[model samples]
Target: MARFEVPDGSTVQAYRFALDPTPVQARALASHAGAARFAHNHMLTLVKAVMDQRAAERSYGIAEEELTPALGWSLPALRKVWNQRKTFCAPWWPENSKEAYNTGLDSLARGLDAWSRSRHGLRSGKAVGFGRFKTARARRSVRFTTGTIRVEPDRHHVTLPRVGTIRTHESTRKLARRIEAGTARILSATVNQDSSGRWYCSFQTLVTAKTRPAHAPRSSQRIVGVDVGVRADGLLVVATPDGCEVARVPAPRSLSAAQRRLRMLQRRAARQHGPYDPVAQTKRRPSKRWRATQARIGKTHAHAAAVRRDVLHKATTSLAQQHQVVVVETLNVAGMRAKGGVRKRGLNRALADAAVAEVRRLLEYKSRWYGSELVAADRFYPSSKTCSGCGRRKPNLTLADRVFECDGCGVRIDRDLNAAINLARLGEPADAGEQGPAGSGPVAGRGATRETDPAKAGDAAGDEASTPHHHQVDQTGTASPQGEAA
Candidate 1:
């Protein structure tokens, strides 16, 4: 179970439990998921047909205002359309709760809205591609908003709208107690089956939890910076403003350890006959051996994911709870992956295994929950290149450099620890930077301090960092003169 604070004087939390369903219950669950997919596909087809008609009319030189209006993609409109055509599209629609169909229609509505917004430049990020039809073989999930959802008094069973009394693998006493005490209300429940053929349900509840004091005690106030990396010695390093080491945690590298077994399972599954026919868009029933092998692969992957998540959650929760202000570097994960080389595959795997983005995400939310502040240093802050003791920036620091030896101050330190200390100093007073040997301060403005010539920064920093360039810390942590260097 995980809890998140909501702004409405309550906490939005999810309690998930593994389900042990009978064969008949499994079939029913599958049917409901299938119905949801069917409804989505049906609405999409109708929408597409209407769009094609409008496009064709424009080709015939019809005025924009004279053309037929396109069909609506809103939930209510989609539901109305689905209701009119349900008789022909799915005669068994009544077999499942109305919420199942509503779930699919709502998903389509949101997708269409996002697509429209992206096309019109109203939405950020990569333009969303058009929504595609859902396939049965893919991951299956369905959410029920208006359902009779409750945890049984026995703390070992839960009841859903259409599915009655499903036993859980673990005790639900935590949620049961909250519900019994009238401190929480289940808003919605989602039932999903993973590739491992395991069923689980997640209840999103509104909980009113006792709020703790926002700030740490004045005497115990501590601000730390965390540097996350896959190093030979440790996975993470926490440092204080004065460049002192506070804590370190080793990387679990769960996926790396489980790779051999996963490869074997995948290979065995590939050898067995399965129902899927990509070229023909059809699937026959998979053989029992094939199913077994695939399930093993899925379980292996799931275990790795679980282990990775557990590590990240624990690390972030501890940081948020303990630190008053946490600072971290803004990493360019995508750019790191894009620069391909002999070690590209290995690097990508390590980056994925590190799960740095997930760590940041967890920290962001958990910090809010624990009343801590999280600061992201400029993406090109050059924390690694700048010496924590001297504030000298090294312009040409190579990847091979594992230890930072300050040219100005003559102080030697581990590269990661140096970076971590630099980050920790970011939240300190502005004069903190000038106290070092080079008499430098944190960048006066936001983003990475750039060089006058764009080519000097290269693609990784150049694409993101804007100019008028500031003569600041370089790649090697060596501070340059204020003016342009000849």
Candidate 2:
């Protein structure tokens, strides 16, 4: 799949606000989301059917061209077919805006394209799995690319297609001011309900952001390295090449703070009547009390997530705006969180809460916005084990050793700070106006590769169970680059 290129001098950004809709509007919104979900499942079923039919025909000695005509997997193709079939399959299609259905078709098209490219080795990332049927418990959402989508001048309400003006829980002045100034244009709007049954509207807009003028920062050292970890005091450490510790952001520990409440609520739900009966081995309708408990659980989780997001966004924005060149080490976050199962939960949970990868992801884009540069250290580079003092490598250093003691100079310092210094030393500062990076260290582009999933990362080599489904040969007995043939 080709990446969506933003226009010059403009960036794509999203503005999301919580919504407060009337009961009628809320139901209508849910109904529209349900329609989108239905379309996704409907089209996916047809696609699978066509693939299976072609494979069966091939096994019966039918020629390639003689097999059933292949269906186009593009958005226009799927939407066209859905439009034709809706009158019969969905007699109540007129209740929702067309954009509701378009939402699902667009998602389906992108998913199919990604899977095809991944199987053909044209995509670089984790192997894309075949799309699965979306159930009622799936995320409720619908995107509106067309129709009436706007923010009211009152700055407390926004309008969407089919769903009339809905009040926002917060002021929309942040986005409305930009809209009025012509600095931002809403390209699309999405209405989604989180697990807590709270509705939110996210406006994806193209923004003409102002870049800071290129100038030397106040700090003499231009490059700063950041080290991310699960440590409580120093979730991430930012230091200069000259060993000046500039910043140390403490871990928000949102989840840890709310863990007690979550545990109690989850236990209460377990004892109540849930959506399943273990003895019957089948699904069942959940009781009202169970639903209420689940809602509480979702709200707690959402609050924790919001707190974590706030902390991360602020930290990244500060780094991007103030630093000239920011260096960060590339880490396999997926590998780090894998194989936790019942054991090793604390480490994995803490790592996830820290969200070490997000700091890098946010800096990658924010750096550009601020006319700054982001440099990523090599994946295999051992920044933690190397002492900043005298550049001595401590191969025997372990996690328990919070302080790095160098034998060469008898220097003792915080391990995280030492790692940060090492990373900062990976490269000198790059010109803000320069088009290329200044790193002599092995430099890789964003999205150059994806980390393998935890389970697959540790899987034994040549293990069939760990292989992707698309790797299997098609019925034609020739290599099928795309999984549809298989």
Candidate 3:
């Protein structure tokens, strides 16, 4: 992977604000985004055509040198070709800034690279497909790397190339103050329209990050384990090594709460003339009423997402600043939400509403920002099934088992609290000195299955870095044999 090693104590950050543009400014912004879409579709068509022609010639017994010339997929090569054909392809391109065209080409270039790498097994995670042409319904966005991108002095407006100065929905005083102090430098600006037709401007900046403050003393040597769950009353359970529950953040359930309103808006839109013609197998212009209904639906979804994100951000920031060592479990959220039978759909929905995976992501970065240590327990550590008091593993545990009961020590506790306690122990100094999950103790039955976690392998995992918790046991009838992360 390519990396940019910045100077010490400097990091890239973004300040995003909502835009409140007049009708004329809005139209101009939309026009620039439309130009970007046009350039992308036109270039993609050409790229595909050239490849097809070469393949056809090969089948006709043409020599290698006689085949069609290869067309480069890189941004610079695309731009060269674009300039040669723009006279005829887009005569009205002068109305929009050149960065608009560059934005589309850059997007296509990156997509093509990712797709090629994925086809050759050079990339990880999900495989990328070929780039798709941007249609009218596609997302509208453009980036400006140069040309008069600045936050105005009043902190109420921003200046962009071709768009002039546009009023902002919120104050930009925070970013403007940083710029005035020379602590932050604007790198680039991106303008995008959301599904609700609201425009937002995000300023990416290179900022000097302040080190951990010496004035405010942090809770040093303290480890707090965070367990994320989908339950309404216990979205997050934070516990210490001594079985003390620090905080229990109740699930906001924003998406679940707005389901009724979303359903109503969707039904209203379905009754109107929409963009799709099912019988003709083509797209048509949607009615104004349908568009209005869609905007409302989009607004509802956006609101839900904002609420969930806000809650998560607050919870994570508070935890990172208070604790010296924060331990969270390694969860395969993608696999959890994978296509499952009808019985698993509700579980998946609840997990998504709670944004269980986002907890680890937030803590991972915020820990660094606050000069705290972040640790991820191994995926197969069995935090929930293992008895925090007696160190007994219950392989018969199921997802329906909300309360953890240990047969060895006869101890009972809340399932999430038990998991959090186990996680907290993983970050302890004594645990780090130990050899493995079982330490230097005697062996039991067959050991459990072990696989290196690709995501958390680089994290400071302490002693339980993908370590086996309990001896291998048959989990044939168990709903969640590995752990309670789901």
After superposing candidate 1 on the true structure, give the runs of residues whose Cα lies further than 4 Å from its correct spot: 1-8, 210-221, 276-285, 339-343, 429-486
Tens digit per residue, CA lDDT, model 2, 3-66: 2445667766677889999999999999999999999999999989989999899999999878
Q: Which scores better on TM-score, 1 or 2? A: 2
Clashes of each: 10, 0, 0
lDDT at residue 450 of model 2 (Cα atoms): 18
Position 121, candidate 3: lDDT: 73
- Tell me the TM-score of each prediction against the true structure: 0.83, 0.88, 0.86
Q: What C-alpha lDDT, on a 0 to 100 scale, does residue 151 get in candidate 3? A: 99
User: Who wins the lDDT comparison?
Assistant: 2
The lDDT per prediction is 0.71, 0.78, 0.77
User: Over the stretch 1-486, how does candidate 1's per-residue lDDT look in tens digits?
Assistant: 112224444545567788999998888888888888989998898877767777788889998677665566666777887999999879988889888898788778777766766676767877887789998776777787686889999999998888778999999998899999999888777888876789888887666652434563322437777898875356778988876888888888988988999888888887787788666789778899998888888888888877887887777777878777777778888778877877678978888888877766566556655656677777777788887876778878776788888897898999889888887777554223322222235422233221112112111110111111121122122111111111
| Model 3: residues with Cα > 4 Å off, grouped in runs | 1-4, 212-217, 277-282, 429-486
Clashing pairs in 3: none
lDDT preference between candidates 1 and 2, better one: 2
User: Which is superior by TM-score, 2 or 3?
Assistant: 2
After superposition, candidate 2 runs with Cα above 4 Å error: 1-5, 212-221, 429-483
Candidate 3 residues 245-309, lDDT tens each? 99999999999999999989998988999999888989899999998899899899889988998
